[model samples]
Structures are given as C-alpha cells and as structure tokens.
Target: MKLHWSPRSPFVRKVAILLHETGLDAKVERVRSVAAIATPNAAIMVDNPLSQIPTLVLDDGTALYDSPVICEYLDTLHDGPRYFPAAGPARWAALQRQALADGMLAILLIWRQERMKAPGQQLPDWLTAFATKIAASLARLEADAPALANGHDIGHVTIGCLLSYLDYRFADLDWRAGHPALAAWHAAFEQRPSMVATRPDDAQT
Candidate 1:
C-alpha cells in the first residue's frame, strides 16, 4: 500500500498513529504529497478527487480516502485491540467523538486560511464564529475526559491529533489555559510512542 501523506496534516497524523499502534507501519509506504486547499496536487487528485492527504492505494489499485475511512479499513488488517468498537453504544460514542474532533480540525483549517490573509481581508464574523466553536468543542472534551480513559479508539487518536495541531499552529490561543482536564489527558496521550514518532516537527517519512 502507498499513502499520500504530509507531515503537518492532523488527518494524516491520525492514520500514522493507527499504523504504529497496529504494527502496520512497515506495510504502507508513505509518499510525501503536498495537498493544499488553494493548490490541488494532480498526483493526489488521481486517487482522491478532493486532493486530500491520507489517501491509501492498495496493491490491486483499490483506493481508500479521508482519514476515517482509511483508519477503519486498516483496523480490519490487525489482530490487536480494535480502534473502532465492533458494535453497540461503544461504537456510536467513538464515532461521535471522532466526528467532533474532525469537525474541529475542519474549522481550524479554515480559520487558519482566513487568518493567513491580510488582516483587513479577514472576516471578523467568521473568525469569531470559529473561535467560539473551538472553545465549545474544548469544553465538551473537558467534560468528557473521563470517558476517554476507557479505551484507545479512533476518537482518541483524532482528538489527540487535534489538540496537538492547536499547539503546533495556534499556540497563541493558549487552548490549555481553561481546559485543564483535557490538557492533562492530552499531556499523557502525546507521549505515546505513536504520537512522539509522528510529531510534525520530527516527521521525515
């Protein structure tokens, strides 16, 4: 398998962490693909029209895309603990958490793009809305930190990546200030071998 990957994308980082956790890192080759919202890469568009990272191409030419789909597919390949619960409330809870984390990532990406524009070109309403959503999401996570300790699932992987991304790109926001519980959870999650190995600053492959 070949993965269209970028060192700095939180979505890609989620998949990378799963690969490490499942002991499948050696099974997939990481291809450094640059996918930007403003500039589409022809290489990635060939497999994923959206030009998204974490696009996985299999040996038979099958392609899996977006981080959630790819992560679930890879989960089936390993015999270890499942990142996706098999059924019942556990599955729904994990999925819901993943959605929340992924949604925040989407917001952060757009917020980042908007902030990158000249200050005068940035829309105040959109900026304020984005900040509001992030704060609410962090509060939700803070309240649910206890549940996060039950198991390491796709939700945990995504939330970990999301928080790390804030640290990486939005340090000025000081996200850890009011969300002490969530911050404490991430402090330990960030030390996992998978997280440490895939740190954006140190990523090479």
Candidate 2:
C-alpha cells in the first residue's frame, strides 16, 4: 500500500499512528504529496481527486481518504477491536471523539493560516472567530475527556495528534490556560509510546 502523507499533518499523523498501533506500519509505504488548500499536487490528484494527504492506495488499485476511513480499514485487518470500537455506545463515543478532534484540527489550521499572513494582511475578526471556536471545542472536550485503554482507539489517536499539533503550531496560544482538563488529558496522552514515537518534527514547523 502507498500512503500520500505529510509528517506535520495531524490527520496524516492520525492514520500513521493507527497503522503503528495495529502493527500495520510495515505494510505501508510513505510518499510525501503536498496538496495544500492553495496548491494541489498532480500526483495525489491522479489517485484521489480531492488531493488530500494521508490518502491510501491499496495494492489492488483501491484508494481511500480521510483519517477515519483509513483507520477503520486498519482496524479490520487486525483481530479483535483495537483502533476502533466493535459495537454499541462505545462505537458512537469513539466516532464522536474523532469528530471533535477533527473539528479542532480545522480550527487550528485556520489559526495557522491567519498567523501566516503578513502583519497588515492578518484579520483580527477572523482570528477572533477562530479562537472562539477553539475555546468552545476545547471546553467541550475537556469536560469529558475520553478514558483511553492500553490499545489505541480512534479517540486516543485523534486527540493525541490534535494536542501535538497545538503544541507544535500554536505554542503561543496557551490552550492549557483556560482548558485545564484538556491540558491534563493531553499531558497524560503524551506519555503513551504511540505519541512519543509520533511526536512532531521541529523542523517541519
């Protein structure tokens, strides 16, 4: 399998961590495909019209997109439920947590875009909106941080990646100040071997 990936993408990181957690990392090959909001890579477009990172191309010429789908596929390859829930409320909760993490990633990406603009190009109102979204999302997550088990789940995988990206790209944001619970959860998640292995590269930032 070939994976179109970027080291710094939280979504990509989610998929990569899932593969490792499922012991499927060795089966996949990483190929860097830069397809940002502005520039779409032709190589990725050939396989995935969306030109999204973490796009997986299977040996049988099948393609998959988004972190959720990729992770679910990995879960099936392994015996027992590891990266995802098998049934009932646990499944719903896992999906819900994944959504929250993805939403947070979107907010952070928006924040990054606003920060990247020239001093005069930056929009205060836009950033304020993004910050507000971040605060609300974090508050919701902090209120009920998922209890992670020994094996990786979608909730743990996504949350870990989200917190790592926040640390790497939004270090000055002080996400820990107003969201103590969220900060504590992230601190605990950081100690996991999966997180330690997937820490963001400083050079990528």
Best by TM-score: 1
Which lDDT tens digits does candidate 1 get at residues 1-205? 9999888889999999999999999999989999988899999999999988989999998899999999999999999999999999999999999999999999999999999999999999999999999999999999999889888899999999999999999999999998988899999999999999899965454
Residue 26 Cα positional deviation in candidate 1, in Å, after optimal superposition: 0.4
Q: lDDT per prediction? A: 0.94, 0.82
Q: Quote each prediction's TM-score.
A: 0.97, 0.92
Clashes of each: 0, 0
Q: Write the per-residue lDDT of candidate 2 for residues 2-76, one digit (tens) a residue.
A: 999887888988988877777788999989778788888899999899888889999998999878998898888
Which ranges in model 2 have alpha carbons more than 4 Å from their true place?
Answer: 146-152, 202-205
How many angstroms is residue 177 displaced in model 2 relative to the true structure, after the best TM-score fit?
1.5
In model 1, the runs with Cα more than 4 Å from the true position are: 202-205
